[model samples]
Target: MKKAAIIGGGVIGGGWAARFLLNGWNVSVFDPDPEAERKIGEVLANARAALPALSDIPMPPEGELSFAQSLTEAVEGSDYIQESVSERLELKHRVFAQIQQSCPDTLIGSSTSGFKPSQLQEGAANPAMIFVAHPFNPVYLLPLAEVVPSAASDPEAIERAKEILREIGMFPLHVRKEIDAHIADRFLEAVWREALWLVKDGVATTEEIDEAIRMGFGLRWGQMGLFETYRVAGGEAGMKHFMAQFGPCLSWPWTKLMDVPEFNDELVDLIAGQSDAQSGHHTIRELERIRDGNLIGFLRALKERNWGAGKVLREHDERRRVAFHAAPASGAPLVMAEMQVLPGWIDYNGHMTESRYLFAASETSDAFLRLIGADMDYVAGGFSYYTAETHILHLGEAKLGHRLTGTLQVLAADDKRLHVFIRIQRGAEVVASVEQMLLHVDMQAGKTCPAASSVLDRLMPIAAAHAALPRPDGAGRAVGQRKS
Candidate 1:
């Protein structure tokens, strides 16, 4: 198994550990704090709950996580070393030196928010092996990891680092040239500065400012960043129109960018008080869960739209689905779709909503399309299967985070029609069943057409294999009360 060594156990380091550990990389951590193990364990628990909710494929079994007594022991055999020590330069230099002494060739990534890679590499034995890998808080869920390499760094090592980060489900943004604060943080710092000024001047309360974001641009920025969101605002005229309309505002006295207020106790207390009034009801852990739940729903929505981070998540899910469930052996189900019930799938009654069952069943039909060569490429070729009718029965309740498996059984098939049955279960119990009738259609003609010979060949074997099995319990049951 691959191994990663983490030299700090603070929030950022713990997040890095969770990302690597959950991705099936063994992790060894070293921190002098007595509570490091307990703290990291808590973070890992949150990660376990949230990360898997974002994808249909389950995460690999977590790798072994152990806390080492010293930094040298952690770095001794690690393939990658991530130093997340305090932001002080001297401490980072000392940690880098210690890492170099133990494993001279291993690439080291510093989780420094402000310092450039060159600054972190100042006193390292091999500057080529050091780079900045800055990740936002809650790293396991958020996909962005800014990878900034200095002039002295090895190009090959940078590429390798990107590969490693991607393997753990991160969108590694390579900073072309080294600069202080990197990209995301620069915009964040400006926003943060403005927010402080607003709070100080009584222009807006902290809650109102937060509401403005979560209710307004935060949703847009989550899927499309500032440029694309503004581009849409430009309408048919496009970005040029947007620039001409808004460019003059750059010189307006609208922002306090040049200076910031002092961090005196009064300012600190006022900000803290307002923030507490805004969100003090929940503990940090509860808030983290809520944030993660919202993020998963938003990302999944974006996946449907095939935009921004959702696109990243969709690609990851496809790769994972292909990896986990390869075209099965001879006797397996004709098609399958796997997923965990997310928070949004639940109703006010605290169980999965009725509409979601139909959605999940439809997913099985989609999987069947992939099985018989009616995928997106094949559909683009002007022929596809369209569902003609669907009948479904809900047998039991599925709560949030319940693991679900839906399997397709082909009951009958003809030249242009397919009769299918679906069974959905959680553990050993059946939760739902669906019956669907699908018709093959020619796109240009918009009429029923026989499936291609290749698809028929694939479908025949599955129909033949399932033909011998005992009929399902709800195979032909009608949706009405029998006379009693």
Candidate 2:
């Protein structure tokens, strides 16, 4: 219902546009580049695919998106304005001036990774409204957004920006003080500098350096981060012990921290060639999709464990669950999950793996629980259902990139038990089916118990609606061929 403006439509700007647009904000974008629309459209396409794919909860219908001819046109009616033009301080100052003139009452944010908030607001008329709200690449997926405000920034404006960001499923890390590169980028620059030294000195190839990251600490960092990870490395002693053990190594000449390698053509060519050799088979778009899929899987995995960013994701999903409005009952099979088979769900046979079929069925169970008033609040109240038994039939094979739908049918239900059937399909073809028997349990008691009346009130209608449907052929079948 609210409107937001994005200035510039490069990678960062387009990403900001996607985040706002997908989160149900009317977005007005201004970029002088001729190809800005097409580029931003492509990013939106990816965002549409990747964002909703992360959860079964129905997202709010996307908001209207339009291109504005000028900065004033974009900013005049916007509630929030994000400036993501080039990194030059002068360019940022010019845009801030325009925004101040057009939308002085609105909260303005910048996507500058390194520039301090003070630098960005130096000459602006309404400097208190402008601050840094830097985000990572593929902004729609990664949740972290550093909210850095200047001394002159309005305290209320900073809090308002953080609130808006959280509403859009972002984790706003408040930077207590404005500094160059903010938080994450400073660490990234340190790593980049060291990596450049490694490549320039021939101590490691570009591919090898990347392998060192992706194959090692990168995975750990994805979940626990630097210090928390090192705490575990300390074994029994934790952070203090680890710090004591590794502190002396800081003085060692293991890294060339004081200087940067010259960026001559030879070094550039060497690094570029190695990078090409490492990943040239796939186009950048292909790589991005792969990266997005991997991130989704990683986040989902962490969500399962309730660790790190996954914990953040779980909190967001809880909010989404509360906001989601299930479709009205129509005696039709309820759509439980609609998603493409992520690359990680495939096996060596190049098709969706058997385990993933079960995963889809599990998702259906979750959706059904939500429908029956057994959502996060219900579960948190110490009552829930647990699967007692499952029977699955592999009807057909589903491959990677296949768009799959899981539809649920409540076969039978009582106060404490539910027998349900789920059909997993690729378009029109039934790829898999699952039959599940679940029992209600009081979590504290750890024993079978009747579910509360509130849950049964919602379940009976679905059971009644599904009572007349023809049974699945494999329903209740044992693992054997029938005799004539």
Candidate 3:
């Protein structure tokens, strides 16, 4: 039940708030900006749907939020402190000074992209307590954070920061050496420099460059990094061949890296002006929504491939699995419990394919077994029931997220065999039904076995309850039904 205090409610801070709160960590936010609260609130509204929907793992109830009166009020007794104010050194140093006085031992981090931890800690009484935990734009979704521990900082600070990052589903990389722009942002800087050159020289409009990126390598870059893209270009020869073939291009005049672009108002206005022209169709908020949606889609597809960023997602999913408590099965006969359907369960045709019905029906059967004493642990003791065969009759199509419940009945059961009739319910109507024949097998001899004495005791009640319930709709007629 550790609490996290956020001192700035800007983009990064708002995302941090969403992440912590979603992971069941109490969050206290303090933002003096007149519009910070409103902006963060809008971000949280999108985050509420996006974050939980990101995983199949049943997340715990999100932690409550408290809008603090002041910075001190937010940090009091907070286990972790995140300072995401403006990127100016003076402003960050000021925040650090207050954080040092208020919570010395608590891990204080700056969400600055370029500033080193040492720079932020400059004017502080206890600068060693502060570090840099630079996160991406949508911190709530993307799970990568760069933890930069200053040379003046304690050795344990990086470890502590990493532990906190892990809890919020972020992979924390502790940079051994500090640099102006750390890791991911370096690539961004390179891209930005080239993009500016394109605009300043009038070779391509801002929208044209954006189109070139979005339609070209930007599409590939979503799932694969730059190195991987080049590796593919090298074909079967790999990086060595790629380097030999294309490394000479660095000397060519392809890029405008010879001269640095000064941060002059005219150039800024030109680029900003074109950007505004290109984006005049939509507001900043709408563009942000579009970007968030793209990020979600990109990251999710990456997770499927289990690539660079997706690997972190896979681990986070594993941790979420360990932390999540699955809903217990309802033992009441013929009751449809959890009928949730994931996107993967549906076919490209937008309906629950026949094979998935078997899988879901099987899961529903598992639920019934769990309710009784014939649970997973019980079956894992070299005595699991094998589904000998299944006969399914799919009456209606089941789309993604369509509530499909199973009303199961022990049509017949004895020591060696189990005959189950499961009706798939969506609201009041029965959408599908299945008859599953399972055999209780002893793995030692690969032969059927009588139910264990302990299992028998639990089975009697379940069988009795299921027997008492009326047969479900779509029950197969005994006369016309095949031997199965």
Candidate 4:
């Protein structure tokens, strides 16, 4: 089983643990926080549902998780270690010092959004082993994680960390230099400082500024980053023209990056009070759920386009292909009466999920039916077929994360009914089979009826074409035998 260790059981640490665990890595957490167990438990519950929902690709069974008694126990024999303690330099240094002694072989990483490996690893025993693996909040939902390494870090360390991050749905950008805030955070800090100044000087309320960003370009920023957005703004004139148009504004005294804003008590409350009014209704978990939903939708949209951030989505698609155990649907034909369990359709017993078995059988029959022209639009009008009864025999366990293929052939069909058999196979082995009896129904009226003349005419030819295929061994299986 894959395994990793997480230090500091805070929000970031819990996020890291959740990401790894959902992707089938056993994670041990070494946080001394009194509430760490409760917090991590909450994170994992959301994680289990969130992670699987993000991908249709079958995620392997998740590994075991344990909270460690000490830092050394967490790191012992682990493949990777993420240090997400508080943001203090001394605290991180102390943690790193302990981590180095405990697990020298483990690649040490920090979840520091505003600090570099050089700063975090200032006096560490093996600074090369330490690097920055900055993950955004809700790490499992958002795939972007910047991986920055210090000068002393080894090349192998980078490669190992990259492999682990990719396994857990993170897109890691390896930065060569160790800047103050790595790469992404610098841009965020610039914006953060300006936002601070806005609140400090009373230019805008927190909610207004937030609305300005969200309703405006921040909405556009998810699919396209700032530069790409500017490129679009450049239009056919291109980047040069776009740069010429807005570049001069850099000199304007609009941002507070260079200017400092004092963080006095009154100023903190002014911003806090504004923010509270803005989002006081929702809890952090509720806000996270909202954010996760939006990010999942955004990522799926990008995945559709196969451009911009969609490139990361495409890479994920490729990874899914590798990790997917399902048999190729188009490349080969399944034999009649043989079982072809689908990866996405099995329960713990390895037998197919009951509804999904019918689903698979129905899917195969639907494909045969569609060649005849009775499809979604045709069904939507007034008439479509419905499975009145289904008989399924699960021969063996179709364990989780296994590939399944289905063979579908029509046995007999007339204007009113379809006689179809579906067999699910795992590799060369037959695992389950379903025989379905479907009735043409007036879907709007919710009752059986004669098939539509237009649809039946088209479907008759294909059903005739497939009818000649000989039935597999279980053709006339008794309903009781199919109950297995």
Residue-level lDDT of model 4, residues 257-311, one tens digit each, is 8876987999889999999998999999888766765666676677767766557
User: TM-score order of candidates, best first?
Assistant: 1, 2, 3, 4
Runs in model 1 lying further than 4 Å from the true structure: 57-64, 233-237, 321-336, 371-373, 387-395, 407-423, 433-484
Which one wins by lDDT: 2 or 4?
Answer: 2
**Superposed model 3: Cα runs more than 4 Å off:** 262-265, 325-484
Look at candidate 1 and tell me the lDDT of residue 233. Answer: 95
Which digits, one per residue and each the tens of the lDDT, describe model 1 over residues 1-484?
A: 8999999999999999999998889999999999999999999988877786676555666799999999999988899999999999999999999889878789999899999999998978999999999999898889999999989999999999998998888899999988899999999999999999999999999999999999999988887889999999999999999999999999999999878999899999999999898889999988988888888778778878888887888777676656644544345454366667877789999999989999888877786777676778889999999999888887888999787877888888887999999988886687998988999999899999999998887787778887877777787778873412
Candidate 4 steric clashes? 12
lDDT of 4: 0.75
Selected candidate, larger lDDT, 2 vs 3: 2
lDDT of each prediction vs. the true structure?
A: 0.86, 0.86, 0.78, 0.75
Model 4 regions more than 4 Å off: 325-484
- Stretches off by above 4 angstroms in model 2 are 325-336, 344-358, 375-383, 386-398, 405-449, 457-484
Q: What TM-score does prediction 1 earn?
A: 0.84
For each candidate, what TM-score against the reference? Answer: 0.84, 0.84, 0.74, 0.70
In the predicted model 1, the residue pairs found to clash are none
Q: How many clashes in each candidate?
A: 0, 0, 0, 12
- Model 3 scores a C-alpha lDDT of 0.78
Report lDDT (Cα) of residue 472, candidate 3. Answer: 53
